[model samples]
Target: MKKRLKLNLQSRLQIKTVPSIRLANFIELPEKEFSRFIEAVENNPLFLKLANPLTPEERVIIPQKFPGTRFSPHCFLSLDEARLADASPINLSPVLERHHKAIKLIRKLGLDKFQKYFIERTSAVLPEDIARILRLKKSQVEAINELMNEVSIHSEFYARSSLGTGHKISYIKVAKIEFDKDKNPGITFFSPRHFIGRYKIDYEKVEQLKKRDFFLSEDIGKLNALFGKLELINRRKNILYQTILGIIEKQKIFFVSGNKDDMVCCLQKEIAHKLSVHPSLVCRAIYGKSLELPRGEEKPIKDFFLPKKEYIKRVILTLFKEHKKVLSDNQTAVELKKTFGISASRRAVSNYRRELNFPSSRKK
Candidate 1:
């Protein structure tokens, strides 16, 4: 018989394990590298050629099993049980149908344009007249008008409650600072409160309808799906706020110096740690996302997380521009250590200088 190595349960339990190769690679990639990977996967001809075709039925997968159970469907009845009990499938609620129709109309009109038209009309204007003006059916217009009325009420309430605070009160429009051609710019902070208000409105509507015996079982499922969307939006909004805060906290000197060329660096790992999530999840959450800054400039979210090497290069460039006397690699490295708390070898500084196309001190 061949000799076999044996381990005690406690020894086996204490053995170290590593994450999967794919997850480890994802977590290790720098912001630029990860962005390039995403771009290649999305747009590269070779990857596109390798993509598998999807079937019509496989286009969307619907979950049939009930939550926390393995076998029971959401209907809670097997086909045999339903047949024995002579139970019928639940019908959609009329209220939910009307809500869907209004959503369809809103999509066609565009949310911003719809809101503009709605606000432009005076209080005296009737729903019927508004329907005629927009070339929409009267019922659809009524439904949308009702939803907007609730939104306006909620907006007013939040404005009053959140006054003098940093909290945002609206989410429908992208908040951006508008600058005059020759004047100071005004800032409008982004807020996601409208998502909560809309969710509350739907919840109240569903409750009222259920109390009146108007909602079918299927309507609850539909409403739950809608609520899930609102929750997702709220989660993304929080992640974005957290990422920005992390950047600001990590680059205090950059913001305080007020110099555009002042280099700032924020790593995804730091943000992931702050948010108590895996770095790969943070990367996935922000990939391909862009936001409008306070100064009216739009930038990719990943641009905020700079690699250590690139950030050091920018710092060296800024140092060169600030000082009139040309400094040798050793001197630059010393300045980096003294000013930015960064310790770089003279050789490394020389390499960075070369990469930045800056002349050496002797050449200068």
Candidate 2:
């Protein structure tokens, strides 16, 4: 017989919300369960290679089958059952009772569904209609309508967010240069130097725990201490912020308007010095992160720190003009290597020629 062992968690279990193909796209699964599944998948290399990987949603959700059933013990619902449980009719009145209860309801419905429910239900009922239906005073109905409007706005905001709704950004756009006495400092341009946002912390719930009878004074003290520690962890900014800011500050002219001519050679040590940080720290900060640009394009942050490769394409174009005819890929590669000491393969030369809209040498 196989032994079934249940792992007891002493600390809080972090839940994962992943995107799904199902109608309920925001699938919340236990961290342990998801980790175990991932491990199982990793064991089968062939299956992993063939399988379509799961993508994570921008929003995080705590899904439950019904109200007051959070950490919902078990989830064994059929697809048909899930499709049938419409969120529009679930008792949303409980949500208005308390802030935490509202959060719970939002979690239960998932952000997408809850927003849909709110929009559909509220749009169908005016304040007067709600007063008549729910037998509430006009003032109460007005309040409810106000809250629903806020919910709708937040929903639309999250839906349109780029770089995931999880990442909140505060940016500072400053002029690239100050006017010099002799130099032609005529044009003023703006560029984003720093990006930041406050960490989300649920302090209201911590304060609410005082009302529970089971929570003794000592427990409250311990909880406060735990919150303090948690706050410290959450409050610390991402180390990469300073590095990115340094890069932007140093390479302001190039980044400000995406003009390649304005670009100057920049090194990681230069950025580190600008930010008063170590060179390794600068490297680590920009390793995997991408910077969102003003033109709705995103480029790897590290790309900006490296030497620009556009010059190679320019040189190839110049060579073609001088030759007064398209050059063969091999011919171009040999010329680049021999004349400029540039190591370019025939394939790379071919690609550059194609990018420049020149016919292949054979076609010419």
Candidate 3:
């Protein structure tokens, strides 16, 4: 290999977030000489006001409790144990029961209803669909499902989501969703562990009584559901991010890949739809959001989300939708090149097409 010539020497700018500084320099100076200098130089009213003379509340060092040699009880005893002395009598059995109930309900009811409940709190189904699934009268299903919702009223929990992390957990409770579009439709009961007639309890009042030693067992349930919601949200976010990033990764070979990826092209709407979520939610995942990897670094979960190449996906989708015949990569490439002003060859088109999951337009 030939030796490379040296380029220009330059220094990169380093942004200092915080460096050393003194309180005396910021506020009142310890020395009179410095105070006089501040008074003379800072002519602006705000600065002058902030200087020695014209200020209203003069900075005074309040006498702090002198660092005593004597140790407090907390120093010798465990803080948690000390606090527990003042805490309410806790019956953990209730909390554990509520937790298990929530888990059982999700497992028994099936993921569809549980997932629906997680998101919207209610999912409507027609009478016939209900009958087909549950083998019950539409009326019975509606009553049963509505009864489940009443049994698991959690909308109230979401109303107070701004509380502490624990409190916020209490705010988004999970309940089995039950709705009948007809006069009465079949309802779903997910939890296999039925303490009472196919229900963890007959009603919320009875259920809420099992306080789990907390303010309300309902809140405890909410807390548990919130964890599941957060996990699901994280998973969805990662999947969306990966898809966007993956497209960009493969787009470099678009010329050779477009015609080969019909199924991949079908996912454009899916990817584009996710990028539009509130940005704060997106960043929320980035800060300390992590998962246990097979490699075990516990990498941030946000790394899964990636920016996708929107333009390329749009082109692929358009080509797939427009092409009626089962055209092979060469024919599809010709059509795309001729009509779309996209300069790509048959092989490249084939690769891209396969990636997009677009079925080949060729006759079977």
Candidate 4:
């Protein structure tokens, strides 16, 4: 007969928002052994074959199932997000509303031209590339000397984002738990759990990080290349302002002429789904953020889209963009429905103005 010794103990080790053993992406370090890192990430069964792998699939997420209960306590999070989410919660209605309005204003202002101009500063486009893309005069392209002083694109404002909805992630995490070994050989485990982090990230720096490279990356070139792809992150706090304003600008079509019924239904979830991101991402992007409009008005970005229609948006922006001193939504809606086939009602229009998040509107 064979006897076994058993030690039953439950010890909980809490990891805060960070501790990434994962290798850096763009900027490489002398201390970090790249070959070993590749081997670990590639999971080459032979270990030495990381240098020469037969399969194209290098980093694979293997899924597993634990049929039952979890034993240990783990507060796992995407370290970066937790840091951002820690420093800023998306729940700040005031900030979100303001951001929404400011972005709306900025879009009305056409900041993309600014972004485009900024990029034109860093990278040059041969006449061939521009000919394939846009139709313009040779002198006009040459005049872009004003646009591209550096003879290249600077990548200051292209960012990837969509509206988002909150949801749970589906990655497998195993936490072995107490089980009866007399009947079962393998211990029970827990996975896919969500927990809050102990520390917070600096959004101020995260914002600063837009123009700058992340502190830890495998290749600076790759990081810079990633920067060129992502214009959202910028060197200034104002860029966050610009981004929200940009989101507002992009969604201007739905806001101005469309109502709750004809409205494009810009649900955060729908936008998130379109962009293939988690809702918390949308939440984070929109949180603790506000804007100062021209009228000395301040509000959160969330207030802009939570309502059903964009009719008020069209009226207000048209008035401001086209430079009309005062135009009523009733008048605007009538013109839109009659001329452009836009759907809006007068009462609904007033409600829309009220939704613009103007504090004085509360008096109405």
Question: Per-residue lDDT of 25-127 in model 4, one digit per residue for the tens?
Answer: 2112211132233223323232212112233222111111112222221111111222223323233333323334323322442434423322221122343
How much lDDT does each candidate structure score? Answer: 0.46, 0.40, 0.32, 0.31
Error of 1 at 87 (Å): 52
Ranking of candidates on lDDT, top first? 1, 2, 3, 4
Better of 2 and 3 by lDDT: 2
lDDT: the better of candidates 2 and 4: 2
TM-score of each: 0.43, 0.29, 0.20, 0.24
Consecutive 10-residue window with the lowest summed lDDT within model 3 = 7-16
Candidate 3, 156-255: lDDT as tens digits:
2111112224321222111111213431211122211110111011234323434434224344445333323222322332322333333333332332
Best by lDDT: 1
Q: What is candidate 2's TM-score against the reference? A: 0.29
* Runs off by more than 4 Å, candidate 1: 1-142, 145-234, 248-258
Per-candidate clashes come to 0, 0, 47, 34
Rank ordering of all candidates by TM-score, starting from the highest:
1, 2, 4, 3
**What TM-score does candidate 1 get on C-alpha atoms?**
0.43
Which stretches in model 3 have alpha-carbon errors above 4 Å? 1-314, 334-343, 357-359
Q: If both were scored by TM-score, which would come out higher, candidate 1 or candidate 2? A: 1
